[model samples]
Target chain A: MKEIRWHGRGGQGGFTAARLLGMAASLSPGYYVQAFPSFGPERRGAPVLGFTRIDTKPIHDHSKVYSCDYVVVLDESLLAVVDVFEGLKADGIMLINSARGGEAFTASGRQVYTIDATGIALAVLGQPVTSTPMFGAFVGATGLVDLPAALTAVDMTLPADSRAKNREVVEWAYNELRRKINA
Target chain B: MSNEAWEGRRAFISANDAVSYAVRLCRPEVIAAYPITPQTSVVEKLSEFIAGGGMDCQFINVESEHSAMAAVMGAAMMGCRTFTASSSQGLMYMCEMLHYVSGSRFPVVMMNANRTLAAPWNIYGDHRDSLAMRDAGWLQVYVENAQEALDTVLQAYRVAEDAAVRTPAMVCLDGFVLTHTYEIVNIPGQREVDAFLPPYAPGENVLDLANPRSLCISVAPEWQTEFRCQQQAAMEAAKGAIARADGDFAAAFGRRWGGMVEEYRCEDADYVLLGMGSVMGTTRLVVDKLRAEGLKAGLMKIRFFRPFPREEIAALGRRVKGIGVIDRDVSFGNAGALYTEAKAALYSAGGASPHTVNFIAGLSGRDITKEHIETMYRKVMNAAAGGAEREIQFAGLRWEEW
Candidate 1:
């Protein structure tokens, strides 16, 4: 069971990102998918959470994701307030939305992928839904889930009026991820 | 129960290993836990299981015990089977989260190694820790031995995961007793366990984004009562599940320890002792010795502490003329901890006919013995025969030789 924990503030589309991921994974045959939010009374701008479980076998647990194989931080500011890498497996990959790219952190011990998801989100969606571009970065860093399926998930989850912009964001992020990973 | 599989496999594994093997058999999709001994070893083994590959699972190591359970809560909210473990201060620390895990109707399996809460700084066995949190809505079971520990841990998942009882379960094994003891346990292969416990498919969860249901979300009092009624119903439903799980476990493992109350030579006994955890092993010998001497003494081992198994306990009370409860742990300011629960369980039945006596001993590994058990039996029988007058009795006190 591959559990993905999405780190983002309440309104930063953490739950939305998780839903998109689940929707994307569900498109494939032999895949069991789930998405959930941390049920709390905390409001917007407060650190909020969403989680996903993707596995070939049926998923039986609906708990928060701890030692995620992949960690995707949508907001750079969260790093100071949250220990995003707390339970990550030593060999796990992390994708962060920072303009400094992967160079911000020393990658000698672990793989760290940096994508300017904020820039991509603002340019395409004209809003700060950093999760869309960050999701692209996550796909780029780890080949565990499919990019096409993820974009398809985005299409399903986004409102029809905002669908074109979200799709463009996904495409742009995927291409950038591919280029960086290949280089 | 068998040596065929473990004949040459006497490896030095921690309580965590036993927990992991049991969890692996239960086949939970999401495994979440935070570090707190003797609970850390459990999560560590799970991490190893995930790292070694083969068991397709999502292993989540969260920042704290709070998040550890929160993670499982979120997963269980999505209608997935989830699990985590904690002990003593850690269990207490997760108090608020514990209420949420069960209140939400999420069947999560958690193991709490009963340990003492701090004061003068002790890290050993005691019941006060878990006892304090008894009001929290989780089905609790206390195991007597390592084998029982392994068995009960697995059963917890089955019981908690049942649709009729979709509630979280906490299986308590005495720290340093069952938690550290090494025994030849018949660890069931995955296939048999799968046959016994089917995959969890909840009726609904937080994952259905399109259908989007609000869970553990705020609600008005009327709706809250309906939810509480459902929770209560599930807890009441667990009694049958416990018995059924015990019987099925015995049938599968070739070891029979059925019934809500495991009676030991209680058929025609005049005096009986009752309690949970490993102390019952020593208590058994005392009952046997008294029975051999024609004293009509026996034991009523209450395995499932929560749900209290009141009817079964009352039945045991009805058979016996007097009863003695040997508690290995105590709750300060209160009477012998387990003793209080036992009396409450047997109170209305026969108006406490068994004349229950409470004996507190062996807190923090003070070493309880067959002799101690003998002293308890004698005291309880004396009380039954009008040799003592105290309604509640204390056995084996050295009195500081003052």
Candidate 2:
């Protein structure tokens, strides 16, 4: 089983990204997925968590994710208040959405890939909804799911008017992060 | 019963929305509800489906949960199938109508998102809301996943509306745990669900102008006992109706929710953990881990709490050395409702009454983890093997009042 915990403020669509990942994984008959948000009363700017678990068999454990394979940060400013790496496994990766161009490092031979999904979102969608770009970056950097499947999930989730640009940003993030990972 | 070639499609959705889709397939005539947290999305989705031309049902906008129940009951009495949903405070607000709906044998089905009653003002999930209404004479079924939540609504209507059992049914989903969680579910085709569940035949119970009947009328003291006895007989009859509904539903749809009580690998096990709702899912996974480690651990999922499944509980009590009852709600001064019921079921049985323990866990939406379940199973196994026993063990506590 692969578990990913998403961190963001309430209006940032972190749970939407988590749900999209699950939807993408569920496109294949071999995978079972669970996507859920921390069910706290959502206030506009309050910090919240969302989770996605993907496995070959049905996922049954319903408790909050204490240990996770990946920690995806939707807002880089949240790092100052929240421990983004708290429950991350030793070999797990931390993917962040930052436009400040943070240094990418291999820590203790584990991958810590950083992508400027905010920059990609602003460049492509003209809004800072970084969920789709980060979704694409996670897929591209880790190869967790196929790009086509992830793009299909985006198409299925977003409306027709918004689909084209979101798809473009996802592709841009996927390519940009793939280049960085290969480099 | 349209049986032309049909197939169920798979979709990823929340239990809340899943109920809406199931309602569309069942084609309930009326839906009246007041939104509450964790449960708000269900009616929200249903409204969307209605406005989007997906369903052609009468949507009653009500002022309060009390009126919501009253509206559905009135519609149901007029021979139209109906649905309403509430949770926690909202459920408690409709307390007066809960009895009126069931006592009249309206067969009105409601999906309750099980949540905690307020103390310090919490909106999280727990079973206190629905379990508090246990004696209100409604059939209750707790679902473990989104698929079951959807499928059980279809089955709950079938069983509740059956001629032998004219009872209202509450299909419960754990508030945030099951309700808000998104899962991939196989949505039975509309024609298929229609085939499994025929249209609501109001029969003699409904209010018809041709043969008018009085309902919700006060009975005299001498006649009330017979009314209570008839309610008990109807509940007893519900046991068979529930099983047949599930079995017949399995023949139509591909899934069977194990009639009343679903046993997970309990035949050869020495000890068993029994619970309802979403915690049982975690227990099932933990049971797998225990079995892998050569521990003879198993789980019994009590699906319907109203019918009680006394026969199955007694038969299992005769075989297992111990049975642990996991309850998400406590009856204040007494044990959790499920533990008390399990003990009562075992006390009168003729065969061996296994040693028992009550685990009062997951109160006010506290996370019931894999470790908590494993520890409970170990306690059950240990107690059965002549170890120390605690009558009511509250799992995952930082410190205990006792």
Candidate 3:
């Protein structure tokens, strides 16, 4: 079983990204996926958390993700305000959507990887909805799901007109992360 | 109910959306609802379905939850399959009509998004609202996930409209936990649902103009007792009806939640954790973790709050060395409601009393963590080893002065 937590402010599509990942993972045979938000009375721009869990067996745990294998931060600004790496496992990875290069933070031996997901989103989608691009980075960093599977998930989740651009951003972010990893 | 093979389409949706889809499949003739937090999405989706021509039903936009229940009651009395949904404050507002609906024997199927009651005014998931109405004479069933929420709604109508047990039913899912969580759910086909639950036939309770008879009228003291006794008898008969509905639904749709209570690895365990609603999912995970550590821990999910599953619970209490009852709601001055009821049931059955503890957790949407459940199991194990100090412990309370 693999659990991933997404940290983003409200209206930044954190829940949408988690749901897309779940929907994409569910397409694979023998995979059980769950996506949910830590719901509270949070208005726009307030910090929020969304969670996704994928497993070979049927997922039964409904509790919040206290210790997750990966953490995806949609906004790097939240790093100063929120403890985005609170419950990340020692061997887990943190994928942050930032334009900065070589910005690093490690907690309890956890690794932090920064990517220009917002830049990719603005270039591809003409906006800063970093969820899709960050999803691409997640796929690239974790390799838990395939690029085609993630694109198919975007196709199913987003509207028709938005799918093409979202797919472009996803591919761009994925290739960018792969290039960075190799470098 | 036919045993014919029927296939269902699988989709990823939230529990609230699942309820809307199930109501559409059931094809309720009248749907009267008032929007409330965590429950608004259900009627919103249903209204969308109605607007998109996906379902042909009367959608009544009532002013309040009380009016919503009254509208459904009126429609049900006029021989229409009626449905509605509500949450904490709304349900409490509709409390009077809930009793009236059950007493009039109008098998109205309602979905309640379980939320915490107010003094501090919380809009989070808890069982206080629905459990407060346990004596209102409605068949209440708490579901653990989106699939169970969908499947239970289909079975609720079957159980509610049973000729022998003409009573109302409340299908409850935790407000945000299950209602907002997205899951992959297999929705049964309309043909299968129709086969399983034929159109509700309002027998002897309808408002017939051809044969005029007073309904819900004032009864003398002597006849009032009989009326109450008959309602009690019908409630008792509903136990069998609920079991039959589950069995028939399983044969038709390939999913069954063991009638009133679902036991998970409880047969050979020295300690059992009992709970209801979505928290049972967490309890199961805790049980598995404990079992991995060689502790004989198990979980029992009480699906049906009404009818209380006395026999099953009593038998479980006798078998397990100790039982921990996790209640999201309190009974005030005694213990959690489930803990109190389980103790009463065990005592009445005159059996060996297993050391029982009540763990009140998740009040007002407080997240019950894995650590809290681990502590609960450790305490249960301690009690089983004859080291119990308290009868009730609040799982996540912050003691400022202690």
Candidate 4:
């Protein structure tokens, strides 16, 4: 089973991103999936959590994800507020929406995929929220889910007028992952 | 009924844990409850299940009981079986939605760990919590033990979600007495529980976005009275539903007890002690002691307090010589609330109202011993024999002699 925890603000579309991922996972053969928000009376800017569980076997345990194989952070501010890296598996990957300024990292060498999803979202989608594009980056980092499939999931969640920008951010994240993997 | 076995089961869990297991068996599509003492553990357990992938339900840890009830109400309105748990003050906090859940006539099962209301601040077992919300149009049943707590919660879903009478019900067990007390509860196997309670269908929920309808909306006084009358009818209807559900539960689980009131040695009795919550267990022990001595005294466990179970209570009043209502909760100035309700139920019943004496004991967890029960019974017998005037009295209270 693969468990992914998404960290973002309440209105940053973390819940939508999780569900879309589950929908995409559900469409895939040999996969059973679940996606849901951690219930809290969080306001728009409050940090929130959404969870996704995908497994070949029928999942039986439904406790919070104590250990996650992948952690997607839509808002960089979450890292300061929450112990975002607390339970990341040794072989797990971290996807962040803050890779724009070419910042180098000396953090542990598991796998880190960063995309300036916020910049892409703001310029293209006209909002700085990075959940949808972060979903693309999440798919890009692990190749666990198909990039095209993840983008389609993102498109379904976004309104039509803003679909083009979301798709662009997703495409850019996918390319960034391809380049990082090749390097 | 006692020896029926479900193996790989016996979990020495708290009343809250038993409640959580029952809720899981109920298969609520949406489970929402806020964290409050005694009640919090159940929600925490379910949250663990939903989080760990054990239960496939939307477990919501809402900000308050109000939102918790709101979330469940919304889900239940959309045809999903819903659940929540709360205690004394928490139940009071969500009083508004309590009416909404039942008024909407949605099948939402709530487990209330009866506790004393705060001001002086007490968190122990008492009926003041559930008793306060008694008239909010919900079917209320009290359980004395952990196993009953578990079974009744599952049955509550069956009774509440049933198409015939789709009103919300509170399966109340005493706080700490059951909520915190650890006991061997036979958690029913999934298949057997499934057979007893089929998956809840959203047939009654009128919410179809395509064809929208508002529920629990304001109505003219005339229309409102009609709705309340319907609510009253449904509560009384629950007396039958409780009987049927208990029978079906017995047939399916081999655990059966007669309807709303569980009678213990009430037959041919001259004196009966009426009680609810865990104190009933104590009362039963007292009744047995009295019965062993050849005293024609028995105990009546008042499980359903809301629809008042007027007929059953009236019949008990007619049969018994003297009736003592041992209330673990009070209606404040009026003394024993349950006792008061029972007296009202008996007023219309013919005979000289069974010397109904109210014993307000076990408030905020004061232990009611066998001696206390015997004393209370003697008082009732004296009252019945001499036509004593004391209607409300305290059974066990500390006093200093001058």
Candidate number of the best TM-score:
2
Estimate the TM-score of every prediction. Answer: 0.65, 0.97, 0.96, 0.67
lDDT-better candidate, 1 vs 3 = 3
- DockQ each candidate and list the results: 0.01, 0.84, 0.75, 0.01
Candidate lDDT scores, in order, read 0.74, 0.88, 0.88, 0.77
| Top candidate (DockQ) | 2
- Residue A37 of candidate 1: its Cα lDDT? 61
Model 1 whole-model lDDT (C-alpha atoms)? 0.74
lDDT of 3: 0.88
Window of ten residues with lowest summed lDDT in model 3 chain B? B1-10
- Residue A86 displacement (Å), model 1: 49
Candidate 4 C-alpha lDDT tens digits along A16-97: 7777677566556667665656543447899888878788864423234678998888988776788777788999887777
Q: Which regions in candidate 2 have their CA more than 4 angstroms from the true location?
A: A100-109, B1-7, B400-402
Q: Write the per-residue lDDT of candidate 3 for residues A44-160, one digit (tens) a residue.
A: 888899999999988888787888999999998998899888888888888998877634564435777789887887887788898999899899888989999999999888999
What are the interface RMSDs of all the models? 19.0, 0.8, 1.0, 16.7
Q: Higher DockQ: candidate 2 or 3?
A: 2
Which lDDT tens digits does candidate 2 get at residues B1-402?
121221366888888988878877889889999999989999988887788677779899899999999999999888999999999999999999999988888898999999899886798888989999999999999999999999999999999998888999999999989999999998888778878899999887778788877977898999999988988999999999988988898888778999799999999988899999999888888988989999888999999999898999988888889899999989989899999999999986786878899999898889998888888888888888889988888887788532
- Candidate 1 lDDT, B273-366, residue by residue in tens: 8887777866776676787888898888877766678787777776777888877666666777678877777876776576768887666555
Tens digits of per-residue lDDT, candidate 3, B1-402, equal: 121221365677899989988998898999999999889999999898888777789999989999999999999988999999999999999999999999889999999999999898978998999999999989999999999999999999999999998999999999998999988888787777889989999988888999987666778897888988988999889899989998998899888899899999988998988899998988888889899999999999999988778888888877888888999999898889998888888785566888888999999888888888988888888887889448888887798211
Q: Point out where model 3 deviates above 4 Å.
A: A102-109, B1-7, B400-402
